[model samples]
Target: SQQGEEDPQALSIQEGENATMNCSYKTSINNLQWYRQNSGRGLVHLILIRSNEREKHSGRLRVTLDTSKKSSSLLITASRAADTASYFCATDAYTSGTYKYIFGTGTRLKVLA
Candidate 1:
C-alpha cells in the first residue's frame, strides 16, 4: 500500500509542551505533507516537505523528512489547548499515470489546559 503509518497513535500533553509524531511509508514519494484536523472537520494543511528537503518549519510546527528511511516526523512546539487535533501525514504518489495521495491513519493529540 502507498499509505503511510503513524506511530504512537495517540498523544496527551499539557499546554506549552511539545508534541511529536512520526510516520513511515512503504514506497517512494515526491513529497510528504502534514495536516491537522479538528473533530468532525476537514484537514488543515500544515506543512509540506519535498523529498529533497530534510526539514521545514512554519510557526510552531516543524517537519522532517528522511527519504532514505521513508519516514517523516512532525513536531508542534509550545502547544496550546487549541492544538488538540488529529494529525496526519500524506504522500504524493504517481501511479498508473495519475497522481494519488495516501494518508496515514493519524495521530490523535490532546492538549490539556
Candidate 2:
C-alpha cells in the first residue's frame, strides 16, 4: 500500500508564522508530491521530487525526503491566514503498476487572521 501517514491531523498558527508537517510511507516510491486543498477548491500541486532528490523548495514551501527512512517533511514559511487549508502528501509507485495516488490523512492548517 502506497500510503503516507501524516501526524497531528490538524495545526493552528498565527499569521506570519511557520508550519511544519511530517509524512511517513510504507513502501518504495518513484516520487512524492505535496498538494494543497483550499476548502471546496480542487487540489493544487505544490511540488514533486523524485526519490533521488534529497530536498526541494518552491517559494515559501520546502520539502525534504529521506529514502533511507521512508519519511519526508514539508515546511511552510511566513504562513498567513490565507494559507489556511489542508496539506497532503502523496506517493506514486510506478513499479506497483497503479497510476492512482495514495494520499495521507492530511493536516488541517488554520492560520489565525
Using lDDT as the measure, which candidate wins? 1
What lDDT score belongs to each candidate, Candidate 1 first?
Answer: 0.94, 0.91
TM-score for each prediction? 0.95, 0.92
lDDT of 1 by residue, 29-91 (tens): 999999999995999989999999999999999999999999999999999999999999999
Task: Estimate the lDDT of model 1.
Answer: 0.94
Q: How close to the true structure is residue 91 of candidate 2, measured as C-alpha lDDT?
A: 94
Q: Given candidate 2, what's the lDDT at residue 75?
A: 96
Off by over 4 Å in 1: none
Write one digit per residue (lDDT tens) for candidate 2, span 1-113. Answer: 43999866899999999999999998898899999999958999999989999999999999999999999999999999889999999998564655768999888999998
